[model samples]
Target chain A: MNKPGNLIGWLRKKLNGISRLWIVECLLLLAFGAVGARLVYLHAGPNEVRIQKAQDASEFTKSLVPFRGRILDGSRNPNILAISLGVHDICANPQMLTAATNTELAVSILSAYLKMSKEDVRYKLRFSDKKFAYVKRFVTRDISERLWTQITNNHIKGIYLEEATLRSYPQNNQACHVVGFVNNAGVGSLGVEMTLNSSLTGTAGVVKGMRDGKKHEIYTRRTEEIQPIQGDDVILTLDQQIQYFTEKALDDAMAQHSARAAWAVVQRCRTGEILAMASRPAFNLNEYGAETDMSRMTNRVLSVVYEPGSTLKPVTLALAFTEGLVTPETMFDCENGSWFYMGRILRDYHPYSRLSVADIIKKSSNIGTAKIALMMGDEKLHKGLRAFGFGRKQGVELPYEEYGILPRLEKWSGLSCSRIAIGQGIAVTALQMAGMMSAIANDGFLLKPYVVKSIASSDGKPRFTAEPVVLGRPIDSKVAALMRYLLARVTEEGGTGTRARVEGFKVAGKTGTAQKPVPGGYSETAYMASFAGFLPADKPEITIVVVVEEPQPYHTGGVVAAPVFAQIAEQTVRYLNLEPTEPVEGAPGAAAPAP
Target chain B: MARVNRKKNTADQQIIPPRLILTVLTVIGVGMGYLGIRSRCEQLGSEIKKLESSCEINQRRLENEESKWAGLMTPRSIEEALTRHGLNLTWPRRGQVVRIYDSRANDLALVDMKDAVRFAELERVALNE
Candidate 1:
């Protein structure tokens, strides 16, 4: 053995290397345990929360648009006036679309699909720095499907589709004013579209889903999605057949007379339903934006107001008959078609020296009507006229309907009473005139005029319906009967409205040729020729009002407007199948419902 | 040269337990189970998304067909078609129609034609007055 100190020193030297190795091995084992612990924490601990948070951060919400409603006619064979069709708006995220991809190939395919030039497509794709861009809009269903297939098959990144709707008026311009059209921004701009827009455009839907950092939808992680609710449909009380016929008649009248404008309204006599309302200078709903003349877009049935001229004679005579002021056999001296009343010369188109009350209305004599008004006085005339649905909105389902001017009794001028008696001083709308005549045909009850019949929800269940609202009875049934009989005589031989007679049917109507009022007096040339009439006079079915503004060659209501009324009436009578009745024997002076 | 030569043989003689090996296998099996569940969840999400999109597309198609049918039946289009094909149809008159009356249905009497026919043909038809 060696010394103790020497032995200890030799053993320590050998263990020194081993001690360093053991320290390194312990450190290595500790690192492995720490790494294993970290892995477990990441995979099963707060990592799940982080992953969910990541998904939430990448999520986005999208809005889905709903379909707009349709407008349908009231005919048994309903025709669509306005409808909305589904379309797609082709869009792209510029950041993901054209960068680092086959730019040429993408541009070429999109260009062909969009019918755009490849250079244009490429330029648009390259120039936009925005994340989103509209490539094309209002893409049809056929083209959209093809494009969708192309994009999906080629895995076109960033290019997307947004659901959009397109409004279509298949009638084009026929009944356009009533159906109206959607604008470039898809808002209803006129007529029924503007009137009932809330019911037409439905509520939009929302969708919540997760997207990756690349703005790609993580389809599996969708949170919430809702289908959009579609809009309610509107059914109108307009008969497309009658509307078409009325439009055709007005169009022909406008062309023939070189008139500034023309309009017509046909209403069901008993129900007060507006069968048809049409105005000329109408624009196409499809190209409504291109229509430059603002006035041409006006629906003149309730908008335009003018003096009704001789048409007021029937109203005056009805008032007299209602008040027991005159009988059909009572005579009035017409002063040979001219008479000075309240410092104004009241004249008739034809000179009549003496006319019974029935002949006075049948001949539409101004002096006779003025004399009768003089007998009744101003307050009575005003009350009678107001009761006839004048100077009030007919409550029709249309926009901007006017209550035509009817000055109060206190505001009557010196000649107001006499002049108004001849349909000159007062003004009335075409719809009002039609409604007034319909009341007479409906046996004296003034029914509120309405166009929209019902509104149905998206599921085809009716949400609201309109029933006939009777305003009031302006006359007794007996007086209305006498009035109808007197009106029938106006369409007989030697009467002014003989041109308005329909074959196989005894027609009843009055002619009004109102001279447009100038600054100081009436115009010598400008006139509104109008005829208000009903057919099968014994039992009236429909009332028609035809007005032609400023006829060129013939300016009289009898010549210009009466023939148009005849054309419309004949067709309508045939369409409605009104049977021929035996002509009542009156001998030119009898009234009182042919009793 | 080294005193550790005999210690190695003893260390090498010790063997791993079956339970420890089973534990290792169980950890691997749990990891694979998590992967399988995650993959299945992703697949189900994709299928749901596809189904939703399909439902939406079908709704769109239905709406589109309704619009098409309505547009095709517009009066102007129908009139154009009628004029284009030279149909030249007109409304039938009253005389052109023949009435096949059912004696059981008294409601079939012609409208606005009662007085003249009823009074004149009273003795002609064998019916109670």
Candidate 2:
């Protein structure tokens, strides 16, 4: 029994040792197999989404918005009319505020700095389920700084400031319509702002890199970085000094006449550069959205159209002179101020029996001017008017320019030639009238008006420059010279536009008091009083046009509009320091001031 | 016999290779230099980040100041200042204005009489009309 027991014990020990070895080997083999499988799977696996999610957790790509450009006024040392200033949007992360966080204190502090109600701040911070909420947008720098200091000192967890830009018009309503205003969506809405939006908006940049727990970029681990390109700055042809003078004059006129609206344009005759263009009832650009009436935003100088009245008379006479149909000396019978032609009565403002062509213009005789148009006929007149930039857009650097209504030849009635010659049956913009006067001023060459003078990049590199563009030569220089001489007489003692005379300059211009066209034929009470002309007629420098809409009791163009023209011309000529074409009273060898 | 003993003593001394030692020393030196440069690069990058942030803050402040200056420099503000100061100013009279032709500032009274007469032409048409 002892020998068998000993043999059994020895077998058990041997078997236990072999089985334990096998178990250890099996476990090691399994571990090795598992590791090998994982290696293969990692190299070529269907875990693309998982890998991307992991990468996204550690990597961040941020897009940076570039700076919007500025709008500058035309001066030797330019003034910033419209600018984009760096501002901050105060925001909050409600999720970051824990139970231990004193949210009430944060809200109280935010409301005080943001100038908002405590309830508004509390609602945004406590009740909002959103991770992010804007407390106030475009806060001033001082407010943002004070809030940041409070947050740091109090150890507030949720509040942050996001960088932003605010478009600021420093001139306020001075050149509001010209500089235009930006909408809530940060888009240029009108005038040159809308026209040059693309050039003003710059390209955005991108950065790709790793981020830390605090969401700050790990610069050393950055993979890609593309820098942003800033936008181009636009320099306008509008001189701020001249623009102020113009706006003041329009405001005075609006108050004096109790007119519904008024608009004016002052253009450099040689360059077609707009020195000053103003529309009445202008709203402050900084508070553009406050004015509920959007019609006040209309730039009437280029957008509004009306019957040109006697202002078109000079254009007609200039056309006639171009056609060689009549000289200044050509005589025509006025038929005692009224003439019946084609079933319509053409009448002059004052009675005249007979007058030469020059005297007809000087006296503004409607019958005599219409007789000359009758000789030209409808075809020649329409063609001639088209050549003079009528019934078309002058392509100025402004939006909503109206093509003043000149009917097609087929639309002309039998009396069209007679009536149109007297500045009826034709609609025209103030810009067109100014351009026509500019043509006469610039030797019969019609120039395209432009407001933007030049564009420069953020690096101060010139991107574009606007030069004087001659649209067409509607009349010969000889005819233009003769027309200028004829128009100059309108500001003389016996002419209709005598009020338009500048004291030290030879003022040449025409006045129009057109009755507003209503649903029937024309309004008996409402009239548009307008004057279009230039100064120093021999060497013209500037052309000015003033239009007052629906002026009370006094509605004559000569009485209402011409004085405004003279006021603008006098100041502008003095500001430009133009050579005195007139003699001084006391200077040696000089004559007295003009009558 | 003594010289042979000296030679034997010299032969018993161990020999070392200069080239092998130099190669190992160069490898260790290069490794230490690479580590130093890498550490310096990281320090510079951190400094650059700080500077960039400071620059951005300064730029924002500058823009704010410039915008405020522009607002104060507007024509309306100047006019208001004038009114506040009670400064009564007017445009110079025609006779009082004297334009400098070219670079010269000669007295108008002493200028060529013919030039002054040419200026007189402006008034002639007023009487004629």
Candidate 3:
């Protein structure tokens, strides 16, 4: 109700009483309230989002690598065939490296320690735009330590190491095909490595954590962690010494005979464990990456098949003997080493008019064997061969093993019985031949062969252990005894396998010299000479088979294969310290003692 | 109103409460203790990191030594060493071995005396051949 001028003056008077200090205080209070409200919003409402934002800024996740397993031989004190050694992959942050002071000095030091060219090191280290590059991979522990010391002492920037593993074969190419090599991607590529890859490769782990401002992991802030598991170790049944002996003998024979290729297998007769299996043209595991020839990597003993020639004679004769069709004294007219049966001509290495069953085996008379097979006919012979584990895989631990060709009974042709009986028109692997010999040595029990002895985990827990598996009993124990007796004479005086005798022990064996089949007919020049045998015929300990492919000049089994067999058997018996069962020829205890 | 004002002034003039002072002091002490524990945890974490790295280095070193040992034990290595030393060692032949029979009293008898002599002759003949 007062006048406008009076009201204005009164308002001015009230405003003038309020000081600037009061306004400043009011502004400060407003700022504090705003700050408190923001804190409440972050700490109380939707706090998880703020926490997640902070973690995203500083947290990191890393994968942990697992260690691969090892392969060892089955010696009393096992030899390591393959192993995985921890190594480092030398890496660099090239952007930081290029910006680092004294970059040339660091490059020179790295090159010297890494044993690489200076240009390579500089090229890897001088990329200013790149964040990371590999300076070197799989650097050994010794070299990595030296480089680490240099880096720390000289304050070299951006150079770091990533942990990894390198698969190594200490024995080089000695058991190359048995203990295969690992590829660059940390995977097993061949042999036992390929077959047992899963157990040999372990599981990796994960670790998530928060890193500090300098990009260093803050271990206390680790959110999650898992421990990696190591792979299992595989132990093979090979004896290193015996393997050495067999390989050495085979090498010498290959050179002596000018052979194209050679392979051999040594097995324990009682237990079907392969002691040594060697093939020529083997590739070195350490240098497998450089090898280009596929033939050299082939394990011919288990992978290749050929006509077994006369080696199958003993099997046929054993079947005849089992069916009570013939005895050691049973006589057969050998037709003077030539006979016609089912419109096929059968001939012997020697022309014998008449021979006992035992002499037929001793002299390797094909006509006598065919006549015996004619008596037994197709049904019994086919059943007997199948029972000897011919048509199927032996289920050995090796990879890519072929089941050698064994025709079925229904597939047999008119001349199948006589021809198959003489070891023609039927194919067999060297392993199959050795198994057949082992069956006889085991008293007619056909045992499955295996090379891997045991597999154990990193914690010493057994994963797999091999036990001798009896596949089948083909012949009776009595027939097996008679077969062993007749086969023993094959290595005695006037026997075809006389060269296979071990100076002081009786050897039971068969010799085979098969012509390599060509397009239209058999090759007259190329032959597979093989000898399959066991020592101390009465109580056999070891069974050995040696096959030499395409030997020149001398192609007969006794000439090319038996001597190698003799050398191996002699060395094995001496190495095993096997007590001599027979006296020396001129020893006082011998029937014909020295004067 | 004068009486009320006098009561308020009296209350304001009283000494600061000991419980309030203790509470303020305890809050500062707890903050300082939290700082101390946090710093100790960081220091221990750094030490653990260093120890873990050293452990990894030592593990690599041990693996290297083991691989070297295995390589040395291989037959090829042994044979190379023997050849380098010019040692032509060979296993004894069967003719060179002598059998000894043991009895209950631990009495050992050498068997095949005549055979041993004959073996020597045979070895001589083999050498001649």
Candidate 4:
């Protein structure tokens, strides 16, 4: 091999022979290429894969309204009686809409979907000066969806949809009283809405984000986002089917009897769950604003107080039985239809010289009822009725509920006891009368009436649930059973409420044909005909109270209200599928009695 | 003599060809130019982010609307619509339903299976009665 030094010398000589111009050219080209690559990266990388960032200060932010919750029926089916829907509030960016090619086409589409006059909608849209104006607010999601589709398909620009909630009653006027209505200003006003306002009104959301000039959110510039907490939905104890039937019956009765008003309440005997409570002259929850008469807004069943007529007899007799004063078989000497007692005359519809205590209730003998009241004394009678949830607030989940007028025992005169005994002096709400009857049906335990069943989260988890709250056992269970037995006789042949009988079910009820109290004395023409009853006498499932105020012509309870009671009870029993247990002794067409 | 000269020329050309070198530089310059264009598209990037957020909000609103619309088309509403259209459908009477109670199981069953088995029995009873 050659010497190592000779190879090194050769290599060095080759490198040294290269031209400086060529070397400089290569170096400069490489350097320029590197710089070019860097420039390309800095420019194109931003355009191609630019990182998201906060937008410039030319953006807008808005408040997002949280949706209100639903009011459903009881635990079983949980049908939505009241619900909040994200209705589309169709707003027009008037400047953009006026600049559009087919603004008329868009306006016509909007008007048809919103159920508005096209001219009105066109007027709202033609204002080029307005940046934004409402064409229609709170249109149903159904109509809005169709409008949105039409807008998108036709490319009819400039109309924007803002998310908003509308309180909608899907059943319309079915349970209008209980479901209540919401104000145009987006607040609940009456009934369950007023009672559970806080729970129904949800927290609103605030978004501190940049928006474009076109009112679109600039997500990159978002600073603060507080998500809304939606409201908890309330569930009610009302059965929609039962409520519908009760309303229909009451409507017919009110119209047929030509009564000033009518109201009814149906309650679960055991739980005090108001299955259906309605008062006619009722307004539609959907069209609540259109109804000018505010009198229809009152829940007459719970709000109006009047003399309950003979419905109070069973309650008084139960008090007497509780006091060890009189048994059901105790005899009373009626002064043949009319008797002078304590300077006032007490009269019966039919003259009876002698009537048993049970017959006193059956005939609704005022003289007999007064003697029973006299035996109990004014103080005992007052205490008994009060214990039955008469004078005090029944603690129902309703606003503006009245506790009917019951005079203090000290204010009562000698005539007051006798008058009160006949259900004339004491003023009681239809609800209070129903509750007392419910006590008898519920083995004398007066439970607090509740319309709200539970409040649930969006995920169907219960936030709150109503438990059966027992107010008191006003009378003994045995006394209640005995009262049920005697009241059943009132619906039999020759009794006052023979018309109250259902074909299949044994009806236990009391009829009341009280004269409406005028400014001076009671009105002879105007009467509050009422029938309070429960069916399947031995084991009652439901207790109903029906009252027709100021009924015309045939105003007796047996005549005006009893037939309606029969219709309601029969339908209700069939709906509930309570088997026919109590059979008629003699029937035109009878099935063999069950063992 | 020609073969020897050609081999020497190939050996000299091995020092890095001018064509190859210029091609690589041109590629780098074009890549840098494209990157510069991409960096200028900040508005488009933000627009994409906004579109994504808008899509999310729209999806939430769609869900809420769908549920409400479904609820509005309940059986009762449908029936009312039918009634309005003059198609009358009466409510079932009590006798039509043959309720079977299983007391041992502590349950009740409402059986009326389409004008068939249970319904046929009801019809037969009706014709006989």
Residue lDDT tens for model 3, A315-425? 999999888898889898999877887676778888999999999999999888988998999999998898898878999988989899989889988788888997888
Locate the minimum summed-lDDT window of 10 residues in model 1 chain A: A586-595
Model 1 residue A258 CA deviation in Å: 1.5
lDDT by residue for model 1 (A1-595), tens: 3999988899888777687788789999999999999988877886877877775689889997888988989876677788887789988888887574665667778999999998777667664577988888888787889988988888778888887878977777888778887787878888899989999998999889888888878876778989788888999988777788888899899999999999999887766778888999899887787989988789999999989988878888888888889999999999997787666677778898999999988888888888888889999889888888888888888888889989999999878888888897889999899888877876777778889989998889999988666776777678889989999999999899999987667888999998899999889999999999887788777889999999998999999999989888878766655544543243232221221
Predicted complex 4: CAPRI docking category: incorrect
* Candidate 2 clashing pairs, residues 3+ apart or interchain: none
After superposition, candidate 3 runs with Cα above 4 Å error: A1-53, A92-111, A117-131, A151-158, A584-595, B1-48, B101-129
Compute each candidate's TM-score over C-alphas: 0.80, 0.86, 0.85, 0.78
Fnat per candidate: 0.20, 0.32, 0.29, 0.05
Q: Which ranges of candidate 4 are over 4 A from the true structure? A: A1-62, A93-107, A125-128, A148-158, A206-226, A584-595, B1-105, B109-129
CAPRI rating of model 1? incorrect
lDDT of 4 by residue, B6-120 (tens): 5456666678888999999999999998787666554675677679668755755765564565356555566678988999876454345443434432233222111112211
lDDT digits (tens) for residues A1-595 of candidate 4: 2999999898778879798799899999999999999889867766543423333445445676777777887635567777776667899899998888898898789878888898898888777978899998887666787889999999987888987777878777777778887798878899999888888888988878667777666565677878777788898988877787788888898888898999999887767788889989888787898899999999998888989989889988998998999998899999998998766677899999999999998888888998988988988888887888888889899978888989988999888877887788888988888889988987787777889888887668888988667787788778899999989989998789999998767889999999988899888899999999997788777889999998888999988888888877887777766666654445432433333
TM-score of chain B of each: 0.54, 0.56, 0.58, 0.36
- Of 2 and 4, which scores higher on lDDT? 2
What docking tier does model 3 reach? Answer: incorrect
- Poorly placed runs, candidate 1 (over 4 Å): A1-56, A90-136, A146-161, A209-223, A578-595, B1-48, B93-129
> For residues A225-262, what per-residue lDDT tens digits would candidate 2 score against the true structure?
89878878999999999998999999999999999999
DockQ, per model, reads: 0.14, 0.19, 0.16, 0.06
For residue A452, model 3's alpha carbon misses the true position, in angstroms, by: 1.8
